[model samples]
Target: MMRRYFQCLADRDAPAALRLCTELVEAGRSPVDVLLDVVAPAQHEVGRRWAAGEWTVAHEHAATAISESVAIALGARIPQPDPARGHVVLACAEREWHGLPARLVGFALQEAGWRTTFLGASTPPTQFARFLDDADADAVAISCSVAAALPAARRMIDASRETGLPVLVGGGAFGRDDTRAKALGATAWAPDARAAVRALESIAPPPAGPSVNRRAGIDEHAELVLRFAEFRDSARRRWAAVIGEDAATPLADDALDHALHSLSAALLTDDSRLLREADEWLSELYSARGGPSCAVPALWSALRAVVGEPLPEASRHLGLLRQVGRSAPRLI
Candidate 1:
């Protein structure tokens, strides 16, 4: 069933995908089961294919649109449940544009008997807080997919807590464990929607207390944010010099921006693993695209050079990444 649905996605056949799901539901499968078992895994494959360069970005987007449509369609077919489990508001972190995961969580919660309101993608902290003002929500759930959005997740957590609501955080940004979630002062962390449902079953509003201080290297992160444009200009120039190009292509420029964002996230979290993982992913992406082997190294060098004296911590992190790069098997 997964393979057939994936083919439907690959073929961009939304109707076929919806029919497949409908067929499953008619066969006595739960709508939520179809969603979790079929749609969710298919979407994961979409990401995997995109990362492996097996599908173009446009192809991935089209497939994702189909999957989202299927999820929404399945959601409507779910028999309305009592809001007996209390209300939960779900949102994606600011600058975190991927909302599908959060949407899945919202639907999963609905299936689990919780009334939910999904705020969609890129919700600002102030905006989130404003909504909570009139909302009778029992708790808030935040989903973030990238490390760069961790700071925004932290801000959202703060906003939820300010209203005496505990924040339940999940998604790729929090890693495979609660380390980052706890670091950001989230009330609880769940790896996925099922885990989230279980976590919320035991969740309570946090006690009134002072906020956790997770800003050990925040000054460097702030510096990166403050001088981002200047650093970009410098990195661009350095990249051209090292790569023997007059200017970077749009894709290369986007990669550079992502690299810098990862650096900023590393500094903000005081975790070098973020940078290491990013470097590894980019290396794989570049290799898959048949890009030059030096591209990733040159990117790191350019970022390192631009980092210079002002951001010693970021520089140190980049140095660690470079070491990892050297020791790892050459992707290209």
Candidate 2:
């Protein structure tokens, strides 16, 4: 039943997907089950297919749009309890644009009888605090889908604690376990919607402490990231120009954006492993597209030049990127 709905989503048939969802609901399937089981898995598959290059960004977007519609519909159909379980707020960490996962969790909580206020995506710490100022939320759940947003999550948790609300943090950024979330000072970590509900139910009141302003520690590569930012546009322009000269069909804006995003991700973490993975992914993507041999190298070189004096990790990534380019496929 879920498979057919997923197929409709993949085909970009929103009406069919909605019809399938309606049928499931009419057939006595739980709306929460539809959300957690059907829509969630379908969206996950869409992302998985995108990562594996089986689907383009467009396909992923189309699928996600359908799933989001289903999620909203499911939320509307779920009957709200009279008294409500409790009040909680859900928000994505600052700069975290991936909101669907958080939205699903919010819907799940709502279905479970919690009065949930979902703040949507990329919510800044100030905005989070401002929202808490007037609203009487029992707890706050911060979502971060990327490792890069961990710092923001930490600050959000701290801010929530200041408001006398126990903070429950979740999302992929916390890893398979709650270790990272615990380290970030969250009262509890919920890996999924069920766990989230449990955490909220058993949440203890915030410890009596001063309402001090706590900020996440400064990122180690902040300076390096700023340097990269200074020349980010220059790098993208150079990459496109090089790709244009070398390939019959120039690389798409999406591809160039991905290249810059990969570079930024590596810069953010100061992790050599991420840079290596980015290099490999870009190399393979270019190879599959049969783009110029110079494309990858040109990008790395432009990056290195922008850095002026490379940081220790930057040098390693630059070396790795150069190695990747040497074997990159060239268009005849």
Candidate 3:
């Protein structure tokens, strides 16, 4: 069934994908099972294929659109339990464009009897705060899928806590655990929708208290952010000079932006693991694409060179990454 569903996604057959899910539910499979078991794993496979260069970005996007349609259809088919549980509002972190994960959580919460409102992708902090003013929500759940969005996640958590609401954060950005979530002062962290429901069950509205403060390194992060464009352009030019203009494609540009964002996120959290994870992922991705072994190192070297003298902290972080790259096992 899963293999057939993957073919439907690969073929961009929305109707077939929806039909497959519908058939599963009609066959006495729970909608939640079909979603978490079938649709979610299918999406993960989609990502794997894309990262392995077996599918184009267009293919991934098209498949994701079909998956979203299927999720919505499956959600609508779910017989709503009476809204006995309190309301929960779910939003993706600002600048975090991945909304499907959050949407899945919302559906799971709804099935579990919580009243859920999903404010789709890339929800800004100010706008999210305004929504809470009228929402009367019991708790806020923020979803983030990338390290780049950690700062925004912190702001969203702050917004929720300011309203005396405990925030439940989940998704890839927090790593495999709640350490980063704790660093950001989130009320709780759950790894997935199932865990999120359980975590929220344990949390209640907190008493009025001082607002959660942003962590240290804000100043250095700000400095890096201010010069990001300068750093990006310098890295691009240097990379082009060394690797040829033809090699500096938009994908390469995205790699540079991702690196810088990961770096900034690392600096913000005082965690080198964040950057290392990003580095390892990029290295594996390049390796999978049959990119030259030198590609990742060259890009990092260019970034390190252009980070310049004014930002010693950023340079130091890059220097550490350089050492790691040297000693780390190379992908074959």
Over 129-202, each residue of candidate 2 has an lDDT whose tens digit, in order, gives 88899889888989987655666776788788888888888886665666556556688888888788888888
lDDT of 3 by residue, 282-307 (tens): 87788887776666767767777776
Candidate 3 clashing pairs, residues 3+ apart or interchain: none
Return the top candidate by lDDT: 1
Better of 1 and 2 by TM-score: 1
Candidate 2 vs. true structure, TM-score: 0.71
Ranking 2 against 3 by TM-score, winner: 3
Provide the overall lDDT of each model, using Cα atoms, as 2-decimal numbers. 0.84, 0.71, 0.83
- The predicted structure with the larger lDDT, 1 or 3, is 1
Best-to-worst order by TM-score is 1, 3, 2
lDDT of 1 by residue, 227-250 (tens): 999999998888888666623676
* Model 2 poorest 10 in a row by lDDT: 211-220
Once fitted onto the true fold, the runs of candidate 3 whose alpha carbons sit more than 4 angstroms away are 206-216, 322-332
